[model samples]
Target chain A: MRRILPWLTPLVLGALFLASGQQEVIIKVMGGAQKPALAVPDFRGGGDAAQHTGVFNETLYTDLDESGLFTMVAKSMFPLAVPQRPEDFRAPLPPPPRRKDAQPQRQGPWLTDWSAPPANASHLAFGYLAVQNEQLVLFGWLFDVTQQDVSNAQLFGKRYFGPLSADGARKVAHEFASDIIVQFGGAPLTASKIYFISDRTGFKEVWSMNPDGSEQKQLTNYRSICTTPAVSADGTRLAFTTYARVNPMIFIHSLETGRRLPFYNQVASMNATPAFTPDGRQVLYASTASGYAQIYIANADGSGVRRLSNVRAIEVEPKVSPKGGEVVFVSGRSGPQQIYKMNLDGANVERLTTGEGEASNPAWHPSGEVIAFAWTRGFEPGNWNLFLMDVASRRVDQLTHGAGRNENPSWAPDGRHLAFSSNRSGSSQIWTMLADGTKLRRLTSQGRNEKPVWGK
Target chain B: MLTKKYVAALLLSFAILFAAGCKKKAPAPPPPPPPPPAEAPAPKPNPPMITLFAAEPGTIERGQSSTLKWAVEGADDITIEPGIGRVSANGSRQVFPSSTTTYTLIARGPGGEARRTATVNVTAPPPPPPPPAPKATFEERLAREVQDAFFDYDKSNIRDDARATLTRNADALKAIFRDFPDRSVSVEGHCDERGSAEYNLGLGDRRATSAKEFLVQLGVPADKLRTISYGKERPQCTESNESCWQRNRRAHFAPGQ
Candidate 1:
């Protein structure tokens, strides 16, 4: 196994760099007995990588909660020990190593205890990376907290020929993680694409392609803010929020028609974040009609007007199950954004995400078992991360290496993969990855794409 | 080396099965619902009126509402009602006055308004349903529900509802005979919107069969009335309502057409 690390290290690094920086998560577990499982990605890293002697610790937690595989716990419910901000978190310039390393760099503040995590999380997979001698090195370990032992660990370090940027260096780390995921017999990831919005086209509009940065195309040409793009269960009809001369309203475009229809008029209010229900019979959308963002349901024809949530809260990104029986949305009822769910008739409201940094833009699986959402690190701007939660087991899995701003996750019709937008590769672009955060790929190569919605 | 490995891995990931998941959104199981209780006397007949909503034209003076009018002519007590502000009918013109109005008009009265103001634009009113045609009463609903012959799913066996339609047909049959004496009456049966159109047509025929058998049982002679099925093509309600479907799920009665 140790001998194979050197040979596999270069392949892992190459895979990471080629992933196109659309999504920096989707790491798999290489060489494992559990059928090659992948970890949940949470892409939320920030700051210069040179600070911690090039060491970046990224954790990819495999969630068996959804899919009836195992129980899951929401990471928001996990007792996380917050880190105190250093007066200067930036890494100080290092002295010449030739000069006896001059003054040794001060040790960074230690990460607090993760000893006893939230309920229902029995296993945790963690990864760490560092750049030594300008060569990237990675090590990963999955911990079974119940047993208080390392369930899995491996070291992978390699050098990349040609000039590679820090983005390429981080991607090398992600591939190593995905390797472990496949060893556990989980579904192989790698076929997905994220659609998001960016101002690269000189205006905020929607663009998309593949998660590995290919086949990029602009879906909307509106000069105004065309933010929300909701994909249908079959991945054909895209319901998105468009702002015309009137207030921001929702609309749908048929991939076959290339024709845009007025989905529903929000009547002078900002109607945005069109999420399709599982049955494709209705769209759960958000509007500013209630003085703030609130969830509302409109028939596929946009006729029926029923409010799904009514409270002093900002509820946006209403995603419904394929059966159209239940809906999960982001609620700001608890001061910060959190994930919550209620039935189609607005009964049995349950809070699933709490205490996480501004949970938003949740996308549900077609099977109605899992939900992927964008999370922010507390008090940090531009630290959007991705997280997953299983419905049955209530287990939370973090899928990213905390790389850069990643948000707006959209799942494909089959629910085995997700697409999201990220700025980790410098400019914002759409990315795709397997549902478990493996086989990371970039679907958009040019322009800025955000808020991807898979087709019907 | 790094680029090659990422390239190779991306290709290998494709070599495996493309990511796919369970295609599950099962249709909801048919729930055991409470059978409607006697259909509740078919409710009072709703007065038909040319109710219209106004669409705004262009920008008018801010804080100034436009006037919209309507005219109804169905019932006697002509009480003109406006959704926002009250309007009166003077010389057949109902004027709606409001400040800062969107020019929206909602009218309710015995006689519906011919002209409706949608915003600041003048709209040529929707043509009213040409003078009131005779409304089918509860007796018509009851008569429509009665079938000449009702049959099992795939069988043309006569059922209970067919007996009821035939019993009612006995009186109507006597009246027809008194008018023409020698003329024969043909019974047409209609099936509800439950089965396929073609299948319902056959079911309708079965209903007609049951009704004809009852007529035969009534000693009305066999060669007089023939039976036919229209199937579920005609619906009582287009909206998604079980009550409407159930109402539609019956054998309709027709003398000829």
Candidate 2:
């Protein structure tokens, strides 16, 4: 929808009739559902040698990677191989390691000297920028470590940005890196935005910024006590609990439109932290329907809803798959919180992880092959780290070896990595890592980045 | 002869235009109207009033007709909520609340309209009071209920049995959204408990929200529906199978002060 209203161009009064000719007679089709693509016919006017780059590219990638979808290896990490041959477009990736110990390193390494593959990293990603005359071009590729280069280029995406200025350059770069996974990965990437509750500004509105952590825009910049922001499947909407009038209510907000629609509010109980359906048709959340915490669902426009689950346990932190076909939620049903999954219609019940210590905020890897969930280590009581498990093999793999209560794992669109808030460095900063949990890179270095969501 | 007359008329108009163009044009001046109201009566305070009134049903029920009515003092241009669509300048709209759904009204002009939401709970003859409404097996029931909400997703709002259960549940409701002199309630969100655990957790939260809303329209306060999502966090069906997931998709209300 371009959505970016044109702010340029003069309103020449004499040109009123001219502008009228350009005034788009947009027949707003089916509300927010399916908007017809501009239907840009395949006019193969091949992109000139000019590279298109904007200020938001990097900010988008940082946001996307921070979403935990891509295991982004910074341009600094590349072997100077990608950019050197941007014109050729075919460069061989590094060879795969024989084994953790088989590589030409100290054999029989001690258990602690070698933590398992970082977050059980099984994949690697590389991104680079190329400036071709008038435009800027960014390139990224993901490879399966085990299959080596045998893995097809999972990501060969690029973003063509508009004009750029000195100040907008950095933002545009990050937007590119963040969006590569979305365009090429074919899923929602959450890293491009920020969700923060700033009581520091005297108001507790939810504020978001570009992934470069710039362009700080305030979603609710009021004293309304807004917290726990849950981004919808597409990243255009935010579902969070707020105490606007002293009563806490769950609000569905349009980030682009700044329209706040209130539902299930003014109740004796409070509704907060909504997880939207995969199709963005409904929102799943917890409420005190029978007086105890139970799960519920409702349409995206907020109508025709019903209950799907009932239990006496305190359940929360639900992450829905992109298909809206299944759901995984946190439940203290067994004395401690555990993760569970079920159908979209709330059927075919099954428990995936159990006996683990307080497993909360489970994120589905973009490929849907594995799930990355925040869990407390078995031996360590307070140390929380992100864990991954194969959906089919039922094998659990740990991602974080460092302590610091890394929580709220949000998956990126590519399903190769995730982003989470780690206090490891003394403050809350958003960090990204490979799905296997290797190559950890800190993205957000300032002001409490919590609840990271990959945006589309 | 006609050509000469036309030419003469054209020449006369041309001459008039030439004379008008030659005349001196004055620079716009500020000799305008009344001095800015010396005191601006403090923007008369906003008054509270029914900004909308009308029936939800555009037509009448077998015995009932939907009526939407609203009024906002000191204003023109009033409208009833679209019985199902858009309303015009009137405090009245038509609807059949019990037999049809889509009952939501809003009156707008200058002041914001007060909101009133109600789904039509049309009875094919006041269903036999649910005849004990014996609790169906958890899985069978959850599937049925989920299927109910699913229809509205394709078309309209709650209908038939879904409305029956909602209405019964509504009958036992109280204000859930009041803050003070009020206590908070927590709703456990759940899904059909199928497919991937991650998927179901999200489904449950949505299912939970669906039930909470029906409760609200039944009279519970907006403040009372404390909702949290359990994307398939826990399940009543401990057994791992399709039957179990079916039982899991539901919003279980645990009412507390």
For all candidates in order, the CA lDDT equals 0.54, 0.53
Error of 2 at A125 (Å): 15
Can you give the TM-score per candidate against the true fold?
0.39, 0.44
| lDDT string, candidate 2, A18-50, tens digits | 455321211110012232111000111114422
* A-chain TM-score of every model: 0.57, 0.63
What's the lDDT of the predicted structure labeled candidate 1? 0.54
TM-score of chain B of 2: 0.34
TM-score of chain B of 1: 0.36
lDDT of 2 at B26: 72
For model 1 chain B, give the 10-residue run with minimal summed lDDT: B193-202
For residues A1-456, write the lDDT of model 1, one tens digit per residue. Answer: 999999999999988875653322222211112331222223232233334323222312322322212334455654433222222122324665788649635334111123343334444444434444564544444444344222222222222221134555445544544544344433423244445666678766766554445456677788865666666666567777664443357878875576786565666335666776766777877765655557888888688878888886556677787656878877757755568889988899888876656666677765567777877645353366887776555555667767766777777644566777776887666776666666566666556555666643
Model 1 DockQ, alpha carbons vs. true complex:
0.00
Instruction: List model 2 lDDT by residue over B112-172, tens digit each.
Output: 4455554544545544465686654433433333232221211113456556765655544
